[model samples]
Target: MVKSAGYKMVGGNGVFFPILGFASIIAFIYLSFGDLLSVRYKNEINLSFVERNGTNFVVDGKLFYINGWNSYWFMDHAVHVDSRPRIRAMLQAAAKMGLTVCRSWAFNDGDYNALQITPGQFDENTFKALDYVIAEAREVGIRLLLSLVNNLDAYGGKTQYVKWAWTEGVGLSPSNDSFFYDPSIRIYFKNYVKTILTRKNTITGLQYRDDPTIFGWELINEPRCITDPSGDTLQDWIEELSAFIKTVDNKHLLTVGLEGFYGRKSPKRKTVNPEFWAADMGVDFIRNSAPSAIDFASVHIYPDQWFKRKSLKGKLKFVADWMHSHIEDAEQVLNKPVMFTEFGLSDLNKGFDPSQRDEFYKVVFDVIYESAKKKGGGGGSFAWQYLVEGMEEFNDDFGIVPWKRPEMYRIINQHTCRLAKIHGAYKPVTGNMNRICNGRW
Candidate 1:
């Protein structure tokens, strides 16, 4: 039975009249596009993947820039009907701010409060929750970058996969790091890929695999094989898993999430950041992007994390150099489009102030815009997060809730407007791309 059946999302019309004007608009979008979703989505013409040609993202054969955010909590929060109004508000807020894409988690496989209860088993309620997220994003005209799994233990990621294997008597190493090499663990992960890829949304009646609103499928979120610093273990796993995903769903682009780490192969390149060598995650950016199925290269930067004791000025300079080196590598060596997929400074860091944070964002956004304008350096970026007013409890170091920090929101909106103008010059096949950003479309 479809759990989403007969359950109306809270931010819809008649029964739902929001106190906020944006909420009302969201209701209109939800009701207006209800059964005619596919037609409405196509009419908007925003459903194409931001494909890579040479070293830039092309949408409908024209250059596309990615001005987006990492809202990893959308699916997690939208599972409950009552909580959906918040999701609606956030997406509505993002649209208002001119964000073009969003990167979020598509997998929650683990034992403690897991989305997938066991291997080949899932909680239908949580699955329907994700269905609502995709449907709403389509309505709001924002594309998604959906990651399949997590490297960290926080959300039942690789560690949980290994635990499932151990319970089944696979008895691989006692370490979660072996998730990349263990055959049984790999099989379990592949099963998850097939399940999510083939899933038909309870709300839209479209297979997840066929949904063009999804910009791409990410194999994992920040994959690292710390146990094997040679980087071969992680590389082999990426090649095998990425190829497997293509077999399951050949439509969408695929990428491996790396932290712009330069591994041992090019010892000189590894010197780009001493922290890359010190962290010992064994990720070689050039070798990692060599797989045919991997369509684009991704990198994340956190100067605060890399140079914990550095002043704000030093951190900003590190960020500039970090971005330049990766952009150059993406152009010269990898010959693929590149994204500063993740980069942000946290408020919790020492010497943290609103002005400094704003400056940091400016420096990063400028790097991306400058690279993209030159037609090859950097494609786009997603700051650490986009949080809502009531979600302050989630405040780690990177959360940027627009209501609390209006200045940050202003900075983000400026980037959006600048990118929109640049996109207009590119003359995307969509024709009304400018109107799309201005919310007129």
Candidate 2:
């Protein structure tokens, strides 16, 4: 070896001296330029979980009222690499409108192309897309509520679980409705839950359980046990799943994505508005949300489908009353924070007037605000869905794109502003004490 700079002509140590000089130079360069190769994305780390304060949701010691949207398509579309920009645009637009939260689908099961391919199997690419979706939501200062499964069978829901049971030679009948009570079917669902809670997000490098941007987990979307109209099976399932999720991610809140069904327990409630009962869905809002493990309550409203025969005014009245009853029950009975997780009118339905839809939204938002103001009114709500300009096909008449429906957007924007103001202005009863005031113990 030839003598280099910093190498002295030592007796029989020329090679060692040159190697030491090169090692020192390499270390110096690494110390000076270490961060150049590593790109650090400036991600807003939101670590505050929404905690219940009586009829309110408190985030970071402040009352958190959800003025949000149900964007169930984000996970579905984001899985396709090319569809990411659209999601970014939607979140950006929503954040600009003063919307603070987004409820989106976190799991797609069954098919080979689904997020959870089959039971314990998951598609890494699809999951990474969800990671990006969560990261993007956090980047824009929006919180998320991720639903673990769906009631309907379109995107590998309970029906798929039943099919999985059939394939495994389980003795149970292959009816999707049995998903609530079937032990063999339940095992697969539990496995999926563990996967979601324990997996680390590839994009954010944070475990899903520890992410604060995630406001909570919905055990299942619009859960229903049609066979058992008494609501025992569904309620039992809610208790089990809610407890399991709490064990996995105690930091996040938990809710059952129920459709506000009164069930057969309260004949008066069921008969108040026969349509509200959703007898086919077979769930009791009170029973399902009463479990200690369930931190909050959720309900969806669809007057167009439920009351197809009623006039616009009649439908509006039913909606107002429906909200009033739910709020009262939540305040007096459940005492848990309840929200309208899904509500929107379809223009394609009978008496499809754009103005009626707008009016309906006004009624719902007004009721939500009024309820939130008192001890136990509706705390937050997510309209049926929000779509961008080009994604019109996703709109089954209920989806509202801000630019397309300027008037609806105006109403949504106004209510979002009003709700945000309410959330910002209200002080929590448990400020600094960190106690859940007025909440059910």
Candidate 3:
């Protein structure tokens, strides 16, 4: 009847024109939007998945669990240039696996380079890349917990970045307090919300706090301030940022980036980089550090690959138990639902010995599902990555992309519906931990 978003009409062949138009729409959807129909979302979660009561994510009258895998950073990068095919394949695979969500870092590796001209600028291309992903995933039936801003990997997570990031918390400095509280940052932040919310693609629906496709909008990836552990100032920054996002796009829940908690005997809250403190620093910490920030909580784990690894496969259940205990603690502390935004182990046998990857996957699934089933229940997770091709030897090869390491695929399949007849036994109790700091994810 009418054409907007660019449409032209040829009235002479109106009869056949409608047929052709309908067919084209069908083809486009079949090729890309098929999952919108095939997949189902039990429900979009509230900002409670990061909370804790007796268990984790026991908020908003829902269990709020997440079943996902990761992809390399999407925003502020050149996916159209680097890993297009892999992106498609990865999303397609997860759709088959019954995965409901996927997560990615949203900032450029240079988001903080003097705030000058040479880098980290947010623009059309960045939005375009993200637009592509939302479309692709929708076609395959997956939701997203896209985290904004990644100061942690500002320099590709170099040694110095790690040192500076940890010592100062990945947040902006007091001298640079204006960066967080500045009107400019707020404008850019709101622009980001507008970019995702207003730009409605077949997949990128209104980024409401409850849109299935837009599972959650997160603030910063693995944020850690350089100041106090109780980083009140940093937490205040989160509060302000959360308000900005909700004011514009109240359709979606918000979340603060977090790491799963620590164990009783775990090494001092340090990092694999030896520079920053692991995301979980304070005692039973969760959003207690960034309270009043978002609706959900998020964390990452690469213990086997980055930390000490005694025997992940053999201690699979133990590993699951640890995650359960830690996440539960987080929920209690933060009072929100949670998502294990990143968790991976390589079988490379280099630093921590790669043979442990498989078991790590099993443990991850067990921990996640078990966490979801219990009282508080689980939220979600994004395996380290998908399609980490040319990026091999780049940094952390966390892709579920099938290339050098076939194990990534195997492990993915093990937990996915493609081969769901089998299942891991020691499901963790992580979800029973608790809920949020008022953010989303």
Candidate 4:
């Protein structure tokens, strides 16, 4: 349930007057005196669990916009005592930049330091590391969006799940896609889900389902089933797992973590796809996201990877069109919010320049900002990834270390402040709200 943030004015003579007419005056006072209020009453106005309200997210009856970034390595780093500080640093940096959400992996299956050593077995030490991540993030007032698994092979993905099933002597199809169809594999995955949802955090002593620190649960990262281009295989998998997850823990939001490709069912929408082959990726943005248990839509943008042959200008155009199409579909067709869950321009591309990357980010941010201004289904985004300094081992072509990139940092900070203003929840930082709103921070 959403609580109202409305304020009232009472007179000494037992008379009352509506304060709605003086909104501008009240806003000025709040902004100017925010430092005083922040220390004393900020906790009183703190929002609880994020909730879906049509095409927007709300908390305490106020719109909650997502201006976030991904740090998939949080749990991986949190496991080591020395490296654990990095997770805290990253979250602190994100809070200073005004980011509200973080997307990271919750499942690391069958590998060194794996969260799940096998189908139902988990490492207690690794689970504690994840507990630390949640505890720290909560302190900074950031919510987490944790993915249950990965579609790719990195960090023990579907391949790991398939390998576990094979070792268990479950006679199944040789295809890795069987992870979605085979009954035994399905039960194994469900057991993992139930375990995660029911487990209590060691640090906070809060059951995973009851903690408002979690923004949502992503079923999988960039799920695709090329073996079944008809999309029925993936659609069925999403429906079943999404329903199962809801039954176990309905407090948090849930998304499919799709790359937002159009399939055979969306003939006209296919035109906006990056390539002809995208239509056969076995996951339709509309159909997969249409399940009753699925709360919103997820899309990932990687023009550099998708269209390696295109010039920078050509790639930028595709980025704009790709995002615009998905936003429109979310608003008009699905009537659900859509997040650009992952997007970045790789510096490794030939002839790549920081300027080019900046341009790409601007286009993506512009599309989201425009849609958000109109209260459309564009729910905001998380840049491909963020990293703290000295974490070079985890660095990829898309990794963003804000301190080292001043221009990119400014762009992200400006976007955060703009969205906060739109939500009417902007608070002054040390009584310098004007400076922050002007992007001077």
TM-score to native of every candidate shown: 0.86, 0.84, 0.63, 0.87
Model 2 C-alpha lDDT per residue in residues 1-441, reported as the tens digit of each score: 011221111111101111123343344335533432232346544356678877778877877777789887787667665555566667756655667789888877764348888778888988888888888777656789999987766567888898888898983887788788889888998989999998898878889898887988998877777687777778888888888888888988888988787776676465554454365456787888899998888887777677646788888888888888888788888888888988877767754778888899899999987765653547888987786655544455677775457798778767755654544433221121111111211
Alpha carbon lDDT at 395, candidate 4: 66
lDDT of 4 by residue, 118-214 (tens): 8889999999999889877776677899999877666677878888888878939767788888899899999999999988998777888888889
- Kindly list the per-residue Cα lDDT of model 3 for residues 1-441, writing each as its tens digit: 111111111111111111123343344436643644444322232222233333343334534455676664443233345334445545654554456577764444333221112222435555566666766555554567776655343423212223333354543433333344445455545565555555644334434344445666777655544434445545566777787776777656677665544322335334212123443232223433335546666666655433344555434654565566556654665556666777665545455544466667777777765555454535556777654333333234444444345675555544443212222211111121111101111
Query: Every model's Cα RMSD, please?
Result: 7.7, 17.4, 13.5, 13.2
- Location of the lowest summed lDDT over 10 successive residues in candidate 1: 1-10
Badly placed stretches (over 4 Å) of model 1 are: 1-46, 111-113, 274-276, 425-441
**How do the residues 202-255 of candidate 1 rate in per-residue lDDT, one tens digit apiece?**
877889988877888888877778788889899999999999999998888888
C-alpha RMSD in Å of predicted model 2 compared with the true structure: 17.4
Candidate 2: which stretches are off by over 4 Å?
Answer: 1-40, 44-47, 276-280, 423-441
CA lDDT, candidate 1, residue 19: 31
In candidate 3, stretches whose alpha carbon ends up further than 4 angstroms from where it belongs are 1-64, 75-83, 109-122, 153-197, 200-211, 261-284, 289-293, 304-318, 330-335, 346-354, 388-395, 402-410, 417-441
Best-performing candidate as measured by TM-score = 4
Arranged by lDDT, best first: 4, 1, 2, 3
